[model samples]
Each structure stands twice: as structure tokens, then as C-alpha cells.
Target: MAKASRRKSQSFLHGALILTASVLIVKLIGALFKVPLTWVITEDGLGYFNTAYNFYGPIYSLATAGFPIAISRLVSESCTRGAYRDIRRIHRASAPIFIGTGTVGFALMVFGAAAYARIIGNESALPALYTLAPAILFSCLTAIYRGYYEGLRNMYPTAISEIIEALSKLTVGLSAACLILHRGMKEYEALGTVFGVAAASRDYARSAVLPYAAAGAILGVTVGSALSFLFLFCRHRLLGDGITEENLKNSPPPRSMRKTVSRLVRTAVPIGVGAMAVNVAAMVDTTFLQTRIHNVMEQNPQVLLSMYQGMIPQINIEAHTVPNFLFGCFSMALTLFMLVPAVTQAFGISALPNVTAAYTRGEKTHLKKSMEAVLRVTALFSIPAGMGLAVMAGPVARLVFGARPSLPITSHVLVIMGVGAIFASFSTPVNSMLQAVGRVDLPVKLLAVGLTIKVALNYFLVGIPQINVLGAGAGTLACYFFLTVAALTCLCRETGILPDFLSIFGKPLIASILCCAAAWSARGLLSHVLTENLSTLGGVGAAVLVYSLSLLCLRAICRDDILMLPNGQKIAKILEKHGWIR
Candidate 1:
């Protein structure tokens, strides 16, 4: 029994590390994809693309979010019990349900794309919306297969599919956008427009060109998702044929379709709602925040128009670009990259089996310990990463995106959003824990409370012209902070696991602050001796070194913490030999 438990723990760690590495690679490739995309499409074009995405976010979540998790949970539980036949039953039962929801989602996006775009205050986004509509169905199909593989304790397929999807998006999306822009440029030249001109003409040129380019860029989403579905479908057929054959030989008669769907809906609702909560908040921003800004501009157009005349270039650039691009960087760079892997990426998925096993066995002590350890591991990674990201936002953005006119605001928002990243990371593991423990519904309820607060904050803050983007970041911070606190409180109450807040969070916070200070000073000093980009890079290198050494000095994290990381054993042994583990 002891050996089995130890092996399971090792397997858990191994899977988590693999998933983490894959997710990090995917994010890096995604960032690489976005940088050149931003250059090709520009901020204005990105605005339309983002608008289409924001509108699509919730519906896509509805289609894909719950079913995968529900299926995974059902499948994993059966696998744990050696009920291979039940696993087949569950997958067979889920197929029709998945297809139905996915179809509905696809239809909504395709048929309602025009109305959705117009209602969101960007009729120009309709082309992008239409182009991206098929992604809903494609993504949904991929999710069901991915969930099945995940339940079987496999991560490679999902990881490989993600890489393929990113590659496809990068290759196809960029090519399409460039081609569209080239055509647009030809059209403008034929119409007697000069290449090198004043800001006014450039603004006009962009208005005519960017919409088509944005649509072309968004079409890549549909293409990539379709390819991902194909990859997963083939992989599933290849790997599961023998299992399917065996299951069919021993399988019971099919359950009633109504009963199967009822079970699926019951399982999917909470997981789906919880999973989609963040996207829902983003949709709220898209629906309300953008319209509010438009209203503010309209009410004071004369004043704004006069102000723009003196700063024509800056105004033109900002007028078209700032909102969408800024939000994308915040969502992708900080939210997806900096925060997600801590818990939601692979950690949560890996935890499902152990957590569910312990909970199902009614091993209260084991479950509590498992939950706390997960939380601690999450904090050990997320806290310093968040702080480092905040302080290094400017340099990081410049490195990734190059210096653009809107960069200062983008960097500022990134810093502010970094606070949200900490809380967001915290929320994911806790939510996952809750789901594993069968209190999945609570997270959705708690998220609702947070979303209400977020909406209120965004309404007031985003309306202020000076605090426009910053306000959105601030709202995100507050929303996630509320959810984190709420989730933690509920988790402890239910599990009788009061986490050592000071040990898990406080030490890391202190060390990270010190690291940030050092990083800040390094950036200032390096700037005097090198170009801004080079200086930022130097400062980042210093930050990493300082933070790692500081962790050892403060003992914020120890041998156990290091051992949780990939290549952890060798690294821990070296640290121990060096007297760094104490």
C-alpha cells in the first residue's frame, strides 16, 4: 500500500511537470505568434479581432467548458475503480450530449455573428466574428477527446495537440493577415494614397485596411481548432481501439439517453460555470466597458476632437489600437502565461486523481494534506512570479513586442494586472480542489459574487478617461482577489484544512518584494549604461538570480518545495550539499 501510494504521488508529479512544460511552450509560441501579429494587424486591427473574441468567449465556454470536466471526472473515477467498461459507457453516453451542445454553440456564433458584433458596438468586427464562428464547434470537439485522454492519466496528446494548434494558428493566421494587408495596400495605392504621409491620411488608410486584415487573422482560429480536432480524433482512435473492443465485449446494455444526458448535465453545469466564470467577466467588460467609453467620448466629442487635433498621430493610434491590444497582452501574457500553470494548467489536472481517490475513500486527513500541499506548491511558484512580472512588465513587453507608442500604458496595466495574476493563480487550484472534493457548485456561486463586484468596479473606473485601461486591470485584480479569498475560506471550512498562510504566502511575499526592489534598482542603473531593451534584459536576469538566492536565504521554500519542480531531486541534492536547503 505504501509503495503504491508513493508511486501514485510520483506519477502525479511527473504528469504535472510534463503538462507544465508543454503549457509553457504553448504560451511561448502563442506569445511569439501574437507579437508579429500585433505588428502586422496593428492595434486597430487587433481591436476588431479582440472584440470578436470577447463576444465569442462566453458562448464558447458554454459549449466546451463543463462537458470535458464532467466527462473527465466520471472517467477518472471509473478508471480508479478498475471499471474500464464503465469508462466506455461514460464516453459513449457523452458523445451525443457533446455533439448537441457544440452544435448549438456553433449555430449561435455563425447565425448571430452579425448581431453579436453590432450589439457589442463594433459592426466592423462582424467579419472577424464570422471567420471565428466555426472555432466554437472545433474547440468543443477537441475538448471532449482531450478530457478522455486526461482521465486516462495521459497528458502528451493534449500537449501535442496544443502545440500543433499554436503552430497552425501562427502559420495560417499570419499568412492570411499579411495577404489581406498586402491587398489592402495595393487598393489604397491604386486609389492614389501615398505610403509616406501625415497621420490623418494614415488613420484613414488603416480604417479601410484593418477590418479585412482582422477578419483574416481571426479565421486562423477556426483553421487551427479544426486541425487540433483532427489530431485528437486520430490519436484517440489509435490508442483506444483495443480498450473499446474489450469494453464492448463486456459492456452492459446502453443506458437511456435521457438518463445519460441528465447525468452529464448535472455533472457539467457546475464545472462549466466555474470554468467559464473568468470569461464571463471579460464578456461583461466587452459588453459594458467599451460602450461606456464610447458614450463618454460622444458626450464630450467636441472637447476630445479639439484635443486630438494637436496630437493627431497619438490620438489616431490610440483611438484604434489601445483597448483590444492592451487587453490581449494582459489576458495572454500575464493571466494565461504567468498565472495559469501554477494551478489550472497541469497541477489541477494532476491533482484530480489523488484528490478524488482520497476524497472517495473518506480519508479526511489524507485529503486535507493533499489539498494544503497543492496550495503551498501553487504559492511557491506564483507569488514570486507575479511580483517579478509586475516589476519587469515594461522590459518584458518591450522584449516580446518591441517598443510601440502604446507600450507605456500596456506595461502599466501589466503591472497592475500582475496583482490579479496572483489571485487568479490561487483561485484555480482551490477551485480544482473544490471540484475534486465534489463541492464544484460552490466555486460558480462564489465567482458570481466576485463578478458582481467586478462589474460595479469596472463601470465606475473605466468611465474615467485617465484611468481607462488601468481601471479594467484594477477591476480584474479586485474580482480575482475576492474569489481567491472566498474560495480559500470555503475550502478550509469544508476540508478542515486551515492552510499556514504565513508559511505558504507570507515568506514568499517578503522575499518577492525584496527581489522586486533589487530588480527596480538594477533596471535604473543598467539604463544609464545600455539601451532600454538591453537594460531591461539585464535587470530581468538579475531579478531571477536575486529571487532564487533570496528564496534560499529566507527559507521561504526548502528542499521539499524544490523537489516538487521538474529536475527537482538533483537540484535539491545540490542545494542541500551547498547548505542552501536549510
Candidate 2:
């Protein structure tokens, strides 16, 4: 029994690390894809792209968010009880739910693309919206397999499939966008028209081509989802989940499909609602940022324009595309902000099954240990990363985006968002733990209040000429901060387990502050001798070094945490030999 328990714990940690590594690779590929795509489509074009993307988020969440989690939790619980047949049943029951939801989501995005575009006041985003719609169906299709594998404590399939998706996006999406842009430019230069439409000016010609270019880029995302689904489908058929014939024979009879579906739906709805709330917040940001900025332009144009003097282009103003242009700049900062959460989100996904298994077995000690480890690891990564971004926002922004006119705004927004990213990153794992422990409804309730607060703050602040889009960042910070604290409190209350707050949050906080100070000083000192990009790299390197050392000195990571890694026993011996860890 002890050996089996030890193996399960190791599997959990290995699964998390596998997903984390994949996230890093995916984010790197994403940076390569998005940074250059930004240059190709420009910020104005990106606005159209992002506008469509924001609209897609909630629908995607609605279609697929809760079911995978539901499937995972059910499979984990059944696996814990040694009911292997139920695992297979859970997977079977999930298929129709995903297919139905995906179909509905795809149809909605296709038919309702125009209305969403009109409501957001960016009619140019329609093509991007339409092109991106097919992804919803495919992604929903892919989610079932991801959830099933994750539930079985296998991370490789999920990791490999994600890499396949990212690579496809990078190769297919970027190429298509560039091809469209190059062809459009060639046509304009030779014929004074873009794609047979008369262009009064070069600027107008480029503007006319941007929507299609954004759509072309979106085409890659759709293609990637389809390909990812194909990979998961083929892999599942070729390599059946490692359930043995003996295990299935020993298992108790599986529940009827009707009961299984009912149970899955009951588990899924609250979790789905919680997940949808997060995406709906993004949708809210998209709708309000554009409309409020548009209102500001209508009612107090000079006040807002004066705040961003020379940054808002004349062409954008003439085309009434100022909202999207500004949103695009915000989105640029958002690209970096999302990377931290994306990594932690993997932690959340990896935690759900392990935590569910522990809780299902009524293993109180193991549950608390799992909870603390998840929180500690999340803080250890998120705090330093978020603070580093805040401290080095300008250098990092300039490094990735070059000298675009929007850099100043993007940098400023990133500074605020960097701090917000910490709380945002924390919320994912916390919510996952909550769901794991059976208080799945708490996250939805907490998110509802938090998002209400965020929306109200955004509406009030974004309208202020001086605050403008920075208001959105402030709202994100407020929303996630509240969600993190409240959810943590709720998790403790529900579980009757008081996690060591200092170990989980304090030591990391101290280390992160020192890390940020090191980064700031390093960047300042290196600027004299190094190029901006190189200096930024130096600062980042210094920050990482300082943060790692600080954790060791403070013993922020416990021995058990170390032992969860591959060959952790040998690594722990080395650390203990040096008295670096207890």
C-alpha cells in the first residue's frame, strides 16, 4: 500500500513537470509566432485578431471547459476505488457531450460572428471570427482525450499533442499571414489596388488587407486544432489507455450510461460555470474596452488622444479604428502577461487528478500535503516571474517588440499586468484544488463577485481620459487578487486544513522582492555596456539566479517537494549534504 501510494505521488509530480516543460516550449513558440505576426499584421491588424479571439473565449469555455474536468475527476475517483471499468465508461460518456457542445459552439461562432463583430464595433474582425470558429469544434473534440489521459495520470499524450498544436500554429499560421501581407503589398505597388479593390493610399491598401491577413493567421489556429484532435484520436486508437485485462475483470460493474452521464453533467456544470466566468471576464474586457474607448473618443476625444499624443496614428483615427489600435497595444502586453498563467494553468490541470484521488480515498494528510505543494510551487514560480515582469517591463517589452510606436503604452500596461499575473496565476491552481476537494461551486461564486468588481472598476476607470486602457490592467489586478485570497480562504474552510501561509506565500514573497530588485539593478548597470535586448537578458538571468539562491537559503521548498522530482532522492542527498535543505 505504501509503495502504491508513493508511486501515485511521484506520478502526480512527474505529470506536472511534463506539462510545465511543454508549456515553456509552447510559450516560446507562441512568442516566436505572435511577435513576428504582430510585426506582419501590425498593432491595428492585431486588434482585429484579438477582438475576434476575445469573442471566441467564452464560447469555447462554454462548450468544453467543465466536461474534461468532470471526466478527469470521475476517472480519478473510480481509479482510486480500483474500478477500471468505470474509467472506460467515463471516457465513453464524455464523447457525446463534447461532440454536441463542439457542434453547437462551432455553429454559433459561424452564424453569430457578424453580430459579435458589430457589437464590439469592429466589423473588420468578422473574417477573423469566422475563420477562427472551426477551432472551437476541434478543440472540444481534443479536450475529451486530454482529460481522459490526465485522469489516468499520463501527461505525455497531452504534452505531445500540445506541442504538435503549437508547431502547427507557428509554421502554418505565420506563413499564411506573411504570404497574404506580401501578396497584398505586391498587388498594391503594381496596380494601385489591393486584391482588385481601389486603394486611395498605401495606408488604406494595407488597412484593407489587414482583416484578411488576420483571418489568414487565424486559419492556422483552426488548422492546428484539427490536427491536434487528429493526433489525439490516432494516438488513442494506436495506444489504448494502459488498462489491463485483469484490472478490468477485477473491477466492479460499471454504472449505466444514463447514470454516468447524469453524474458527469452534475459535476461539470458548476465547474464549467466557474471556467466560463473567467473567459466571460475576458469578453467583458473586450466589449467594454472598445465601447468605452469609443465613447471617450466621441465625448472627449482630445482628452484621451492628448494622453497618448503621437502614439495613436492618424490613419487609425481617420478610420475610427482607435479602439482596436489601443486594444492591440494592450493585447501586446497581455501576450507576455498570459505566459505565467499558462504555465500555472498546467499545474492546475495536473493537480486535479492527484488531488481528486487523495480526497476520494479520504487521505487527509496526503490531501493537505498535495494542497500545500501545489500552492508552494505555484507561488515559487508565479511570484518571481510576475515581479520580474513588473520590474523589467520596459526592457522586456522593447526586447520582444522592438521600437514600435505602441511600445510605451505596452510597457506601462505590462507593469501593472505583471503584478496582476501573480494573482491570476494563483487563482488557477487554487480553483483546481477547490474542485478536487468537492467545493466545485465555490469558485463560480467567488468568480462572480470578483468579475462584478472588475467590470465596475473597468467601466469607471477606462472612461477617465488619463487612465484609459491602464484601467483594464488595474481591474485585472483587483479581480484576480480578490479571487485568490477568497478562494484560498474557502479551500481552508472547506477542508478544515490550515496550510502554513508563511511557507506557501511568505518565503517566496521575500525571495521575489529580492529577485525583482536584482533584476532592476542588473538592467540599469548592464544598460551602459550592453544592447537593450542583451541587458534585458542579463537582468533576467540575474533575477533567476537570485531567486533560486534565495529559495535555498530560506528553505522555501521542502524535502518532500524535492523528492517528487525525477531522481529526487539523489538530488535531495546532494542538497542535504551541503546543508542547503533540511
Question: lDDT for every model?
Answer: 0.72, 0.90
| Residue-wise C-alpha lDDT for candidate 1, range 277-303, written one tens digit per residue | 778887776766566566556665454
| Candidate that would win on TM-score | 2
Runs with alpha carbons beyond 4 Å of true place in candidate 2: 1-10
Q: At residue 548, what lDDT does model 1 achieve? A: 82
TM-score of 2: 0.98
Give lDDT: candidate 2, residue 113: 90
* Model 1 root mean square deviation, Cα atoms: 4.7
Q: lDDT of model 1 at residue 16?
A: 70
Per-candidate TM vs. native?
A: 0.89, 0.98
Q: Lowest summed-lDDT stretch of 10 residues in model 2?
A: 1-10
- Badly placed stretches (over 4 Å) of model 1 are 1-10, 191-202, 241-260, 301-344, 558-572, 579-582
